[model samples]
Target: MSDTGGLFDGVLAAGPVAESVCDGAWVQAMLDFEAALAWASAAAGVIPEAAAVDIEKRCRAEYYDIAALGAAAVRIGNPAGPLVRELTASVAPEAAAYVHLGATSQDVLDTAAMLVTARALIALRAGLHACADRLAQLAEEHAGTVQAGRSLLQQAPPVTFGLTVAGWLGGVVAALDRIDVLRGERLAVQFGGAVGTLAALGDNGIPVLRGIAFRLGLAEPVLPWHTERSRIAEIAGALGQASGAVAKIARDITLLAQTELGEVFEQGPPGSGGSSTMPHKRNPVAAVLAAGSAAQAPGLVATLLSAAAHEHQRAAGSWHAEWRPLTELLRSTGSAVEWLCIALDRLRVDPARMRANLEASGGLLLAEQVAIGLVAAAQGAVGRQEATDLVAACCLRAGPDDLAELLAADEVIGKYLDRSRIDELLDPTGYLGSTAAFIQRAVQDWRSRSAGYR
Candidate 1:
């Protein structure tokens, strides 16, 4: 069944990760583990090959009743117990003995969780790379497009829009790298039997572990991690970092698309961003949803972290607490990534508006440049403090008047610089320090690192 119909699901959980963590997907992952375990047990000489083949045939998820399993899970504290029981009943009596041979409920469930996570990451990773590629394109396209750089919500100086997008790209690449490492090295199979030891499997336990890892395509853990939950915490932390990165870009887009700012907007077809009450409003809905989705991640990550304090050999409530939060965290961050892709895809920039807004400050944004120019023109006749004081006096007196014109008309300041020199210093584009180089570096880094993304 499709995971649809919720009011905010389309916006908050709209992606392949949503499907990958659904009930059916979880059931299938568990069944896949059961099938793989049977095959692996047979390979380790722990179960007959014919019995393993029979058990595998009955391990298909479609043969099980998910609703019944959910209800039965309450009795045994996990769905794996009910699932194994049903699988055993479905197979012949000879194969039934080997259905879940030497495996505990946590073994199947933990491995299943990893399988589900791996599948979900396949989509999340793709979406992130897509977002990174779009940012790279934006950075290259707007490398020379100058805009005001704001600090603490006020205009500071000139910076290219390309540089702004490049900053976003850098964060995304970092997040992607963290997630890549976790997916490759940490998502391992959990195979120890009850109490963290494969006592039932004895000498064949390691072979069975290797076989399961090979069949399921997951990393082989050195031992069972019934109580050790660092992998889950690591996944949560990486996803939290990714959500933060996506939220940062979304926040920037929303801010730039503000009514007063209007420097950038999410372009779309008619009726895309219409307001229910205000007809003229063109909202950045995608960015807003992306930010909203990301906003829910920290709390979910916290839940996972809290749940990571599992008791020895197994957890009472902590392990169970991780199930929903972990899946929801995946869903929320995945939604953020998907929404960000849509936002960047539809993003339209107004270079003219950016330039106009930069100039709206009336040269105040370039005050630092002006101060530096004065210090140079003084040629050490005036101390640095004196030049700074003079510029500060000019800025205060120049309110509503052009700063360059005000500086030019100042008697004390006019000795070192003229209107021509002042205007040149106030030029926004001329004051962009290393903006192009930064953009190039960001794009180059993305291109090089992304080449190795699998």
Candidate 2:
């Protein structure tokens, strides 16, 4: 079966990055390397300049039959052989002699892979930046909007929604930084001729390599890394981390958008987040799709990591294994980030519902704060453990009676505390310790980091 045009393609592999890694793009990238090689060889006096121009003119991917190239590639175990042969045949005889000079099939394909990766990364970075910007806006706008903080799937204390959004922003910024570093420093050209040595091109090899690097806007490595797959593995790992970050944010949205909670809703266009059978269901479809797309990344990353163990100077099957997994990884990761951006942009918050939920536990959520307050108010009259036990007992009776009223009526607690004092202790707004500060710090850090990204 074919890999493209699935029912879920628009949901799982949607974005410009998908196009950048398609079969046509791969063929074009290989042709680009061949054209660059010819021009670089001519610049280094290794081939005629006229031959370079002739070869360059024939290097357009639109001129070649991509399906026929794939069919021919099966015989040679790679598409580079068929591509180079076709490219050579398409050009004049002198240009054909100069096509893919002093470069192995591996060199052409590997370099083409780098080209494809660099372009796809550009699209991924844009999606990440869009998500980061939306998160920053939500963080700043809701910096003071208090909500119940849950731990282990149960309500615990209070935290601002801004702080939660800030947390998401921090993760996106971190992933963006890693991707930036990889794009700037690690995308090196792969040109080692045959077996990691440019023995065929003699002394002209280094110059041609430099020329190719300059022409393609890729880094010039000290040596070709035929067997070293760290660059590919690193790319996989970074995209994996990015996908994880997107999943975390999306999962939070799905949880918060639950029907029972009702604290947040995804305000997308009509017909989105719909259920066919269940008309009342307004599912968090964007977040669900984002999470599903991200869920596919870890296994793809593992596949790339498994292929890292190449034998000797060149891999037999290991190198061949990286092609499809890496492409899918890039596409899936890009789709996840894009969906997350859409989810956050459409998110609607309910402060009233958040406050109502915060008060749902009848002051049991503030048991810890009340205990600490009792200890301080008692002023050594009651020990810390005594105060803790007193508060725990009061919490047990909180649903039948208000925890504040229960604590104020307790014999041991009533001596040092009044109803007003207990009320203040149980106030979620008063108990959001360091929340605003943390939100500020998170927003500042994101702004500082995103400034460079912009």
Candidate 3:
């Protein structure tokens, strides 16, 4: 890679992603595959246990020059070949002979990829849980806090902010559940030798495959999946779904933090989110990071899907296409979840501003309630459209201190509804129908679901 990744990675990649999927980690995983292969072969009696111990002793990636190995790998077309050559050279000839006995280049590379991914998932799971828990907490805190429900950028009716957060939390919860399933099933060992057959091992392949998988904490497939690429594509898709879920929340928070409609803001120290030209600005830096990282998922995932369509058995250029994109998918998704955890945890909410925005639409926001009140009060004197028109006309002027006084001034509407009923109808808090119930459902469901994982 370059000194830095693409524009987004520098802005959005978190420390965990950098640590988990870096060249060092990759090399370590490859070395781990070598060590496990040696141990498995020895356990199967293909090699002496003493040779296995010797090979394992030398398998630490720290002992090798990764830069030289990486350069040699490019020329050799894969890292395992160059790595095994150096390994055999380092150990006694008898022990070195057992270094990568039954495995091929793809086996080492693919298994290494799994090891890297398994480590990455540990970070991702924690991030997602943290974010979800924060959202659930916020949902409980703001259960009855009223805000304007918007549709197509226009005010529709009253909705609690808690309900809105519940929707976002719901998406994240689904992503977490999907991740729980995929990690268990997809993070398995890849041990197919050259040409997808362990013909060289002669009936010992299955035992060796199972042994190495057990050593690596991975599942062994019943048969070689050299060409079946669903697991790879599924991992990409699942990761994309997770990033996309968090992106929805980031986009919403960014919108909420807009200057004209500042219902909420991210909690940060002084000078955070400051614009160079506009000193008064406090931008949504955390949301920017969350969105920026998530933005890479779809295209990278598409590349993974394309890479899955490789040519016969081992693939020509197609399999090679997967290395970077898959790593990027893992990095971006994990980083997105990490940043969202920060943004959600430190989010500063202004329930007062949310209520003000709800009422900013004037009594027009209560037009639906007014129309419903008119049906009963007017009896046959007014219809729904007439009631709607009357409220619209009255709303052209600013509302009075009380909506009851405002409507009492109306010669036409005063007879239909009185002051007490008007006050009751115009209250946004009373109009939040089932919003709190939904929020409660979300919080309780989250508590229950998160319990199982814990």
Which of the numbered candidates is closest to the native, going by highest lDDT?
Answer: 1
Compared with the true structure, all predictions reach lDDT values of 0.90, 0.90, 0.84
Q: Which parts of model 2 have CA positions greater than 4 angstroms off?
A: 1-4, 380-386
The residue ranges of model 1 lying beyond 4 angstroms of the native Cα positions read 1-4
Q: Whose lDDT is higher: candidate 1's or candidate 2's? A: 1
Q: Rank the candidates by TM-score, best first.
A: 1, 2, 3
Candidate with more favorable, higher TM-score: 1 or 3: 1
Give per-residue lDDT, candidate 1, residue 161.
Answer: 97
Taking all chains together, each candidate's TM-score versus the true structure is 0.97, 0.96, 0.90
For TM-score, candidate 2 versus 3, the one ahead is 2
List pairs with backbone clashes in candidate 3. Answer: none
Per-residue lDDT for 122 in model 1? 89
lDDT at position 441, candidate 3:
90
lDDT score of residue 91 within candidate 2: 89
